[model samples]
Target: MFDIQEELKKLPDKPGVYIMKDANGIVIYVGKAVVLKNRVRQYFHQSANHPPKVQAMVAKISEFEYIITDSEVEALMLECNLIKKYKPKYNILLKDDKHYPYIKVTMNEEYPRILKTRRVEKDGAKYFGPYSSGFAVNDAIDTLKKLFPIKTCNRKLPNDIGKFRPCLNYHLKKCLGPCQGEVNKNEYHEMMRKICSFLSGQYDEILNDLKAQMEEAAEQLEFEKAAQIRNKISSMTQLSEKQKVLSTDGQDRDVIGFSRDATDLCIQVFFVRNGRVIGREHYIFEGEGDEEIGYSLSTFIKQFYNNVQFIPSEIVIQNEIEDSETISQWLTEKRGHKVSIRVPVRGELVRLVKMVSQNAEVSLKLFKDRLKRVDNVNEEGINQLMKLLELEQRPRRIEAYDISNTGSSEIVASMVVFIDGKPARQEYRKFKMKSVEQQNDYASMQETLYRRLSRAKKEKEENIEKPKFSDLPDLILVDGGFGHVSAAQQIADEFEYRLVIAGMAKDSRHRTKSLVYNGKEYELSAYMPLLRLITEIQDETHRVAVDYNRTLRAKRYTHSELDEIEGVGETRKKALLKHFKSLAAIKKADIAQLMEVQGINEKVAIKIYNYFRNK
Candidate 1:
């Protein structure tokens, strides 16, 4: 282990970089910061100011390494990159695989078609929404079909384009006669154009024209056209009935309304086009922040549209943003037309915003209520963590750390986040060991915490992100009994602040142990659900980290020794290792059964068969 305090003294106060290593000299973490001195020095602070776990992390600082940076923003960008590359244990990692699905309507086609998609690809199609509920999209599609009569089958019109016979949809009157061509091509195209216009945020004009035509057709003895228009009118009427109308005038406008409790934010945007509420959307963001509800709403809308390719003509804001004029100008220029940003002042617009606000409020309340019995993590938990840390307020979510290394080789750390009184699995992190030389828990903890907290600070200083604790955490739980907590404490003290730190002391069996608060310890069993929850968190975090550690170790071991030949991935390697119970047995097995493992494909089986055939 290296001398950590001495290393901290040597760290440049100017903004730059920092590196952390474990007992075996393996680089467990890497990060950049604006102020190296204050950031690096916080690890050796008082235990009372930290959660028992964090206090334990602080105690374990064997060594720390740091570099300087010119500004916090640069540090932030650099930090995100490094964390991504190394995958440190403690981080607010943005999940990369999942995506929101949207409904796309290609209005430009001669006959517009609706499609389901997970992303709004730039194929010149109009995107309706990122509906989180599959049932919602299904229902909307069904309802829309009733009004528009889009073809539900894969048949073409009478030109033999692909028509076989009229499908059930035609019999059910839910589809225009594309199959039999009882409907003229021109008339069908006209219907498609009308649907296209409605989907493209121009419903009022389409509705009005249909009404006028319906009246004129009835007078001109065109009963069929009049009946068709009448059906369209009825469908539109039913849709309008389901909607909570926000406005009635023909103002091509869009309104954004939102609500947020201390830990979550929900925004509802009503798409009011031509004086009627045509369509709408809702979004929820759960993360760290300090902005009040109104300000949060403002920031959200701004960031949201910053990435938006389409800017509506008129945007009705629920609250004022500081750079409204600038943003409005930018949007107007992009739109190639005039754009107005307004916070409605006591008219129909205000009434609309209020309605949206009420809806958002209800949505948030519903969400909170749904999560109520799950785990009650409130301000008190945050305060309790904060007060214990000797800081200002309790942290709403606390991130804890511990590095698990079998020796100098399999170094890794587990990061577990406790939100309210429960764990937020979405926020948990795992770090694979990197460029460090040896195994050292103290140094590893130091580096992991340094990277996590410093990056958080960089976000705040640069205005790209608010302070993590700005939303704050209640406590930081460290995996080790004492060393990890002490290292965390030192880091806090150096920052010249108090944060509740605690150590999760594990038993000799490496199972659920107890908590060390201040200079004393308490059994985890006394906490019941909380204790059980913590154990699960601790166990999960440990498994995640150690599993990664083993993976890396195996990767190295396989490439260097066991997997000296071709035809080996994780699963194949596992089968060979397990069935034979050793590399030697696998090397000894004949080709006939060498290909018998579950995942071993024929080609791979042959390769394995051949390699070990001569072994």
Candidate 2:
């Protein structure tokens, strides 16, 4: 129904983003174009030369969609968001999609606190570092705490002062005890200023000040105070030495470098703050050998910077990338200052880029070696599994199902997937049993399978795009004996879906015992690889099912009748609970008594009274 030529003709002349989807409606590629009509037409033109990757993507394009934007910048923004959301197959994706931790100084409070967080918000707080890991952030915080006696508790200072006894931290000299009103406001603010300076990589000034104080304390014959200052000086020295200085300009920047082989690419990024290299991280991309270095590097920049909490003032790379100017503009907007994307031609920066690229090459080699070992183990498991089940082909994708419940409530089923002997976590799905009211595992299994397969059948018949259930697995596994397997097979038969369907049987101790298929139990104890694979699948399916059941039970336990009232929100609910002491008392209270609660007006009181009276 989707004519490529006709759709190409309909593309507008304005800038926009285009999405290419396959027959099953899975987005294969996403691109931005300054002029939609001209750019989109080039893909379908037979005379146009295209890379092998693009050719493969085009061969699978069954339909396409486009969104017009006001400017090319807007299109680029949308393209980044869409690529992050869908992670299209043909796009270069950063495998390590992690938001590194940051150290936050809550300057917005009357008495500030230093804490570790992953989010950077505009709340009048100063943030430092997208540190390599939580450990790194904790290390920095721990060092600061050792040097400064700042408060760590969440008590509202100045108001909560003198209301409660100082905590153990104050007695141990770990905190300044502002809650006890023992600390001067001016002195505390000055200490916070020094802490901020230390985090900004200004070590020499703080070190000199600490040394001077140590000598002054010794001169005054305060030996213990002088010893403490000496220890603080030592700690500061150690921390500063950990951050190796790379430049004298004291500017923040990121150095990105990559190394590629025939099939794999590794990108390494060095985070430099105040001209010091704080940390480095590496990302691996598979099957990108044919992609241009510029294109891959450009895509990596957009995806990486999009999710991070902080954007550096400069980005240094080994080569010039596609749309460098536009990417710089986007980064500049995000950073609230001018950002530069530079390709170093000579000097120290060029040397730094080469060093990062060397690290990336070493990482790629180690990764490939480890991957080869894992692949061998997985391939053997698959081969053994196919032989055990008499399957015609290797079960590249195996879907395992399990049913879980507590009594007759919150009956749920889970489907876990394993592709090529590794768990495919994104494909795992859970279902809450809708039709089965009682605790019947057979009926629950049947309903789960029926709903799952029905969706697949509907998508296949209608050629639906953005399908919920895409392709059926090559093998079906149920975490039970013969009955569960029989129920699942009945649903599969109704849809004429043919594949190996089996159950994972357990021994007396509930450990994986054998595979039950075609009314026969296949012993797996003699084959360790196959047994381990089956056990993993069975355990994962059970964990998913049980976790869902527990979540539903927790929700039901937390449910309050007051939540059903139209005008009662969390604040009013808390107020009612606090005033009445119990739900039973609230039910018995008159409308006037209910109105006495804060934020609860006469209308809400009447509604609550009527609801309880009717019930």
Candidate 3:
């Protein structure tokens, strides 16, 4: 038996992280402190004043654990990671887990290519703009291509020179045709430098160069060349005009502002680069109205920067955070330069901050209004569903299951979840049939339910932390008629898991027709809200199942006998296929012929030859 009092006494008088857990061993809250002994002991003190959120969390605390760190900075880092991993209930979280798009200049290559990517890696390439809009990134890349005759092909540059004819891009005058060695290396690299400068919001230099080229072309009486140059200059001018200039310092910074209502909090961030406001994004945190603005803003900064591809040199916010200095140190280390977190009291920065905050307020109100409309529709749907099925209470969490297969092969099932009439995509689960060998939908449904219920039972009994299966749904809906409902109910009964089980019956056209419950068909045509809700659930479940089945079939089709051989991975496999044209041709090839394929060494060639000969 674990005692909270004993664990509290054992906390060391050092900087570290503390995790509070409930009786079920689930982490309810995670925090960091300068002194573990002092911080951890404060929660258990009867006379200590605490906020409502902290008080509620403390009441649920059954046990606590601590990890000592060398300094408060290390503790903060560890706390950020833990909060991200566990998403503790008490910690204010940034719920927008978006991986923004970036424009990558592949400077690592001999002939660099400009591309849009979602990931930023340390590959000696320059990246620009973790842009909020993919369409904007695409437009920018398209415009850059028009402005520069850079190559778009993936040829191995100097090595692949003269190996193939110039592609259509070169014929269309969109590329410099480096594959054919038409452009000098130094000249092509000079153009790439101009492209990089343009991406960095340095438009004046490129515009002047374009104007000079146009003037020279016209002086030489080359009307077509001068026309193209004029067009390029026009494009660049329009692109530069789109960026709203905010400062003359040419510094990259982010302006963060927030607004809170009775129940919702919205944090808006403006991305400013090179004195221009490139883009803005807003994050919504529900049920944070009671949280202090400074504390919430601090937590938002830590969580937001943790996953971002780039960190700006300065972060301007409306309020002073308690850990501003510590967060600045962390961000500076991340950015590999000096970073400052500022709360402006006077100047244009203060005005900018206020503008961002006002935008946040407007965004919050609009979001809440939209949410209210959605909530009303969802409530009507739930109420109608309750009346139709005679459910005692609202079914807040509904799980639906469907099975898919190709004849008697590759049987799969999908479990999709809907919470409060909204799809909870993260909670979805997929399973490959283990016991059932044939294309039997009823048997497959039973196996899926049995496995799911068994896991739920095990999770509850073992007190699993961050349990996925233990959270039983308030209702279960299977995609079929009476037979599927009976199969699911049988398993639910075996596990003694009491919940309403129904079947979504579909017509011949694969449209939802009715709901089967208690061996009776409940037509949903009269209840439009319930019908739409059930149809959405049924379609989503079927789509997930079919997608899983298609993925499995694709894998099976892509597999080859070459996969079984050692030292022949995807690259070598493709090489062999391209060289021999077919598996039959590969089998006929001798060791000498096998060695003709690139990446096929003598040892691997012998292994392939021997294996085929033995077969």
- The number of the candidate with the highest TM-score is 2
lDDT of 2 by residue, 38-63 (tens): 98888889997776567777889999
Arranged by TM-score with the best first, the candidates are 2, 3, 1
Query: Candidate 1 on 1-615: residue-level lDDT in tens?
Result: 476766667777687667666566654556555578876666565434543333444444456666566665455445545655665432323333234455667655444567666665667776754444466566666667878778665333334544476677777777775656566766776776666566444567878987999999999999998998898788776655544455555566778887864334678777665466655666765531112445455445444554444556889978886546655765676567988889988877888899888888888778656654554544333344343435565455667776888777777887777666566877777766565548888778777766666666667678773344333345777887776789888877765556678887775445555777687766543233344445556766777787878888877765723465566766678877777787777667666667676776778767776776666
Predictions ranked by lDDT, top down?
Answer: 2, 3, 1
Clashes of each: 90, 0, 0
What TM-score would candidate 3 get against the native?
Answer: 0.60
Q: Each candidate's lDDT (Cα)?
A: 0.64, 0.88, 0.88
TM-score, structure 1 vs. true: 0.42
Off by over 4 Å in 1: 1-98, 153-190, 213-231, 241-364, 371-615
Candidate 1: global Cα-lDDT? 0.64
In terms of lDDT, the poorest run of 10 residues in model 2 is 523-532
lDDT for 229 in candidate 3 is 93
TM-score of each: 0.42, 0.61, 0.60
Error of 2 at 443 (Å): 71
Lowest lDDT 10-residue stretch of candidate 1: 89-98
